[model samples]
Target: MLDDATLRQLSKTRGQTLERLRGVFNAGVGGDRIENMLYRLIGNKDGSRDLQGLAEVLQGRNVKLWVVSAGTNNLQKKKGLVDADVDKMRLLLDTLLKISSRTTKMLFSGLTYRTDIGDQLVDEANEKVCLLIMAMNQEFGYARIEYLPPVADLDKGQHLADHVHLNERGYQMWAEILAPRVMELYGS
Candidate 1:
């Protein structure tokens, strides 16, 4: 979990700024406008949020949000967590329970095939994070939860980069699997 300060700091790093700008621009388009809506829907496949709109939704739903992603390092360092991280995760989960209007639902994922140890580490970490999400869902009595598994053949050169993040094809596969489950669980 990154502090707001930390996320801001990370945003200043070269690539992260571009990523955040892209996130902002992509999330800004409304869903009612045909062209913009299609663009936003395509871009939001991996669960993009307009921070302002998301905050509004949280207010509307009376829910607080927390997301945990599996990065490459989280895998290799399994069972070697720092106490600070453990505490932060616990606090974040607890806060979600306390703040959310309805019961919470956690979204998590497993490790994927990767080209490098770093990617593998992210995969490993994500696996652990997923487990933690499950435990939290149970512990806090979430209304619902879901786990997205790694694509089996993803490492076969279908991915664009380090094989950690997904390409559009990978995202589509992900959305197809996830959207239905989320709809079933939350009634979409």
Candidate 2:
């Protein structure tokens, strides 16, 4: 999960600096792709569970926010798969939106710069990822969905050490930026 402790830390800071808010929930899994997430949602695998299952599990829990950081794994191929991936993502988002209360807010983190895997195919794939983000924001509107840009110049080593995953500093920066927005949405 890209150092979600940073997010927890950010939430803690928010409670200290602002209001006494509940802690953050870290439901992220490492190396999770969009397709894999769909599989998990439907319980297609032995140990995986679908979104309905997840909702059932968290039936009584107070879930006020959801932050999604996916689609980077879908960017290793060509442009042909972009539409399919976007469609799947839209379905996933729609399902989540339907399940959540109107007060719940969602944030989608955009794919960062990939400098290590500098192939033509990867570049094309990144372009598609950006397009997917744009389309989702345009279609859903800010009231329902918001997009978080990469923490820093991802091409630089400080933000993304491996070109794909966020470094420690990157995570901290990301959490710092996102915490305020989360507060705004949650408080409203």
Candidate 3:
């Protein structure tokens, strides 16, 4: 039960207050666009200070922006269209490329293992999600593709817990494998 002034103040505060509760209720309806508002405020033409801006200050050079996403389902839901999700992802990528053609590279990976006690249905859903990931890479030529082979069963435990999330060791290895490719693409 917020009044207009309180609602306006909440919107101005970037959702750190109860007045901003409207944002939570309106979540996922252009959620990406909404989230980008935070990014916009920090270190760009926007009026907020953030890490990216600080790096630009320290380096005495403009900081380039790059986004690497994993576990994006936490950010945006595909509404259980598990099988066709990849295609939808591809369409979104295409739109992004159109807007920001400067995006130099993308590093896409497939699900390699799972041991979560969540449910069998989620495991099956992940497999379908992986299929979409593969399809997205194949369908579009926006960025270089580097296929990371699934780790063998013995090595899977080193990289994954509950067959899905990366353990520290696995993430370290994943970063090691991905870093060179990303560096080469960005010419870093």
Candidate 4:
């Protein structure tokens, strides 16, 4: 999750004031999957109590950058439907791109390794995610959409406590890695 403190720190580091806009609907629902997100986006389901959909949130707003971090929950699903997941992800990205302005920069965070899950399953899911990133970059072009790599040492236990979620130090490290790229894009 992109915390407020990290965004504030990023603003200070970049010497540019940045506003945080959030549109989260379902929170802490283990059953939340990519299909659910797609349905929410299409107005089939209520995405949030306030924000209707992702495009609706962006509509009439001054958005310069969009960062999306999803697919982990989808990958964690028991039934492995990598292709379906990737297709849904592509549709989401395409929808976002259509709704976003031409100058809006987009960043897609890649899947991180989960230690709590089976090693082979995690590896396979990450591989599919990497492929999805590659395909998205090719379709969107490198200049418009960028793929942020997973944290280098997720297995080291210093950053992650549950192996699924990040601890305070992990969040700090994530901010450190993400803020600079955001700054660079803002500057450009």
Candidate 5:
């Protein structure tokens, strides 16, 4: 139901209806909020971290902090758990550390919950992700690597806008959960 093909088909079928209601009930009326939410809804780690400018940006001496908070969609794609998935993540982490400046401090948060993945599997998969973080921390001991456990409670409907992407309150709550860690590393 949450696949790209499905979304494209829905857009095709519903395009006329959306156009008809554009003046009265347009999502873009407010901003790109709805459009951004939809993109994040289908955001999976199919081939994440293309690393287009990763090395270039982090190579700078002033690039001190790298806060990475993503990977819930990996679970949607049945990733971040299996052996192959672990291998790929580890490689990415390793590359990230290697390409980054020596002084770069990384705060890597674990996976958040997806409505599609059951709670049990989410926990287990996030545990695997945590292990990868730990391994990267061990290997890249020169730089600080802080790992926070998975973001919880997203399965609860209040935080979700469409049982998929987070709403305003949901994003605020996520920021609240990470504010302390960000402040700790980033300072006031």
Candidate 6:
């Protein structure tokens, strides 16, 4: 793996600002010295917070269904997806699946399309996300990991505030999508 200074120089050489490099990368892009360039550029996240979030869910409460959604914002940062990103994503979801009761249903939705960033970037990220979720379902051999592809026919500029966040209408639309599935696992 390239050292931080080396990556910093590489970033500078490429004229890519650290702020803009928040998405993803792999050794494949940089050859030998770069192993998961995303982690280096973004700073090692350590995933403590991710683990903590899961821990909180495990505390006393009964959670029959875990509705998980994330990754679009950072995914918007970089131009390409990498294998390390996929590995990290798999590890995170794998932990949840392994620890949670087998009967528990997990519903993970693909990243949303964004007009804030180029739709191309978000759309690309969304595809990687969709693929990872599918892979996780297959690899974990769990029948309960349900995936909802992003909605069709939703007006992004209208439904999203700042073309990224959910406006009131967006929230309603999202709820409509989630409700039936939630009811399926959670009941009335």
The most accurate candidate by TM-score is 4
What lDDT does each candidate get? 0.43, 0.60, 0.38, 0.62, 0.51, 0.54
Worst 10 residues of 4 by lDDT: 21-30
- In terms of lDDT, model 2 sits at 0.60
Kindly list the per-residue Cα lDDT of model 3 for residues 65-90, writing each as its tens digit: 22233222322232332434445555
* Candidate 4, RMSD to the unseen true structure: 5.5
- 1-188 per-residue lDDT for model 6 (tens digits): 22233234334432222332222221122222122333322334376642233243343334466655545545535574456665666665665556566676777766667775666776676677777777767776766677776666668868776655555566556655655665566552
Could you tell me how far off, in angstroms, the CA of residue 23 lies in candidate 6 after the best superposition? 34
Q: Which pairs clash inside model 6?
A: none
Question: Which digits, one per residue and each the tens of the lDDT, describe model 1 over residues 1-188?
Answer: 22243233333433221133111211222112222222322334345663232323333444322333323233233443334444454454444344455555545444455554444545545555567667766775663445667555554377534434455555455445544454444433
User: Which candidate's lDDT is highest?
Assistant: 4
Residue 113's C-alpha lDDT in candidate 2? 55
TM-score of predicted structure 4:
0.69
* TM-score of each candidate structure, all chains considered together: 0.49, 0.68, 0.42, 0.69, 0.62, 0.63
**Residue range with the least summed lDDT across 10 consecutive positions in model 6:** 25-34
Q: Name the Cα RMSD for model 3.
A: 14.5
Between candidates 3 and 6, which one is better according to lDDT? Answer: 6
Given candidate 2, what's the lDDT at residue 108? 71
Ranking by lDDT: 4, 2, 6, 5, 1, 3
In the range 73-120, model 5's lDDT, one tens digit per residue, is 445445335666566556555555665567667777665565666677
Runs in model 1 deviating more than 4 A are 1-60, 63-87, 111-113, 118-123, 141-144
Q: Model 5 segments beyond 4 Å from truth?
A: 1-52, 76-80
User: Which TM-score value belongs to model 1?
Assistant: 0.49
The ten-residue window of minimal lDDT in model 5 covers 21-30
RMSD of 6: 14.0
Residues 53-91 of candidate 2 have per-residue lDDT tens digits of: 454454445557777777667764435336788788776
